[model samples]
Target: MFVMGHNQLPPHLKKFRRLVYISPVITILSLSLLVWTYSSDMTFQFITRYYHATSDPQTPVQFTLPLHRGPGQMGPEEQKLSLMAVNGTKTVLVAAYQEHRTGQKEVRIIAVVLRSETVAYRCLLRCQEQLRISEGVSTTHSDHFGFAYGTADIMCPLPLGCETASHVTVISAASDSNDTQIQEFLEVKNQKVQSDSFPYNFVVCLSTMFDFTNVLQLVQSLEMLQLLGVNRVVIYKTSNSPETQRILDYYIYKGFVEVIPWSLSKFVNVSRGWLPEHGPGDLHYLGQIPALNDCLYRYMYQSRYVALQDMDELILPQSVNSWLELVPLLEMKYGEDKCYMFENNVFPNTVSLPPPTSQTLPPPSCCPGWENVSGVNILAHLYQEPIITETHYTNFKIIVNPRAVFSTSVHGLLSSLIDCSWVDRNIARMYHTRASRQTELTEDELIYDGRLLSYSTKLIPNVNAVFRESGLLPEGSIQ
Candidate 1:
């Protein structure tokens, strides 16, 4: 009832009208600001919880989310991830990322595996920070094989007694609302048994054997390893002949050998030599470094010592017959934690013992099909290439305490938790049998060292039995 005209308003009335109009606008803005601040703080708190829950300060951090985002939307920090089945029940998720400049930045690794019916089980993998040269004594002087590699273990959540799982999707959490699918669900089978369950004293690790044609030599080498007291031989096989496969099967059945399918060809072109620059593969020495590291870890808790060597090489003890005796002697001279390196002594096949003059030679077709094998005949090759005093011997192999070795190369350990020294060739040395440097070397060039003669009595019969058992040789074939 007391409404005033627009032009004839009292001062008090005008002031009150202005106050009423301004108060509502100010109140609305203040309320809006308060709500926004509260929401922002809540969001920040949520993100912080996620970051701390899954990250480590000393190692790389992992982030996990429930949903996946497009690859285009991923931040620069997010790495390209992949999953490889190390064995049947265990799959190793591998990721390569930019090395943190500050060393303080966290790397978050969130892995999720899908069970049947789209049910997902989340896993937090702690990255085993790679061995850095600055951190400890690194024998690996070259960076030819350097890569920022990180691994996470995915224990398959399949039901009891199930060795494989199908249609598994692995997801990683990210900063964006969308989760990243690192790997699509594919068929995953358990290939490796628990390493802790392996009952072996001295395990021999042969890395990345490609295009294995030397069947006879392989069998002889295995037999010699057994003779030398090697309880188990693990070979990362790429491919081999049918004959070799049969031999491997025999050993596997006998529980003396383990063949890890080297599927590196599926990932990248594998080089045959350590110098990738001179070879075709991406990794040095047919990815030998990784395979050696894997073997070391696989046998760390299982075997007392693991010998890293080629299929054609044997670390023969000069005085002792079995490695069981040689190891204790070596450990006595060198501390137990030390990695023992053996000097390489190459013996070429061309300088073999003159065809047994005393005994009549059997017909060419009389022996098993494997008699015409591609590899060096260890029995025939008893003469070694004489050592040149001036030459710097670079080629050597190692027998290391699995727990002490952190990383390894074809020749020796790259990094060890303890000291490493060259084992005196007088006590033990590596006998490498291969094609002779020259077609014919004189008696002066060849040093007659018949170390293998001692094992021939047993090696010949054992190899013959395997050939017969595998149907490669007849029961009454050459005895």
Candidate 2:
């Protein structure tokens, strides 16, 4: 019987022992070498810089993620997002993000392209080894608001074993010519989106602000929204009066508003009206549909629900006090798929003050402190157009679950798993306090609902505080 001893082993055994002894030393030396390499200038530029997509891992990388393969210098500039125009095509890329909800591993690009333009899109996925080019499935949204330019979704499926994408860009392909044109790479969002990260119960999406100077109404409406359970309001602003910007800034400072610069005019001439024939522009309402879609994706994982509304409008709950209260009741009845369509009951801004209500009318608005303000006073107009008692109405707004929606319109959802169920006016309705589109209706035709008046007590004080803090109102003017 032959046995092996530690010191008296065979030559191969001795060699194996020496190797085992040096293994820990080799491992330690390798680790130390790595640490030294990283800690010193010996580190490769590609290795350290490309480790994280962003400096602050919690926040997303803005407009540009550091890569240099695209043709353009950069695209449109909103605060932290990009609006890139594809070369030799009418296609404009608003934002690109990894969408996991659709059961396809793809980069969903929200864009505004011509309804009939046969622009073939390719998704340039920033992969680990190579820039993957995948043919994108383009879907031009149905609700284009009768405009030439419509909101489209370019779904580019990710390559095999690609768990996450670094960044994404869209390229225009020519059928006649074999050359594909690539634009700038946009920060692919929603991959790092922490679901329910914030406590915003309802987020409001005001499509665009074009030449807006309505200060008084903006304040009242913003305050009213806050009171009605809106935690955050995302405003896509093109240009606004300084006074209006100040109000927007105040909300932004308060962390209640996100102002995304709407620079669609830089790329395409945006139409002032819904139809292209109504003006000499290309897209409708300053690329509002794209903005709405971007807003949807932006907050899809951030909030429970999103309300698409105008600055002058508020979707007030009739039975419930706040939207936080209202949405749960709706979801309970509709099972999370119903887009809570509220009847658009316009309260004419033409009326100086509504007929006196039972509650003491404090100058029909925020008391006497708002006379110098430049916008509409929502509290002043309590009477609105009579609710259309039918099952549906043409003019209506919606409060929707962002996850359930794919594409959005100014008034409703274009593509949503969410079915439109007109919320009973008794449950909730929209107070669209704009210049009367119902000018044909007589003064007597308008109904004095006084529903908005119920919130005037708290709204007035809250508004007064905002005005006083914003220096919009006189310090001692409590009259």
Global lDDT scores for all candidate models: 0.59, 0.75
Q: Give the candidate number with the greatest TM-score.
A: 2
Q: In model 2, which range of ten residues has the least summed lDDT?
A: 60-69
- Residue 65 in model 2: shift from native, Å? 30
Error of 1 at 332 (Å): 1.3
Task: State model 1's lDDT.
Answer: 0.59
**Model 2, range 141-255, lDDT digits (tens) per residue?**
8887677788899998998877778888777665322333334688888886555556666888987889998888888888888888788889888777766665665666556
Model 2 misplaced regions, further than 4 Å: 1-78, 175-183, 192-198, 353-366, 388-392
The pairs that clash in candidate 2 are 216-375, 217-375, 217-376
User: How far out, in Å, is residue 316 in model 1?
Assistant: 0.7
Which lDDT value does model 1 have at 79? 21
The alpha-carbon lDDT assigned to residue 295 of candidate 2 equals 91
Number of backbone clashes in candidate 2? 3
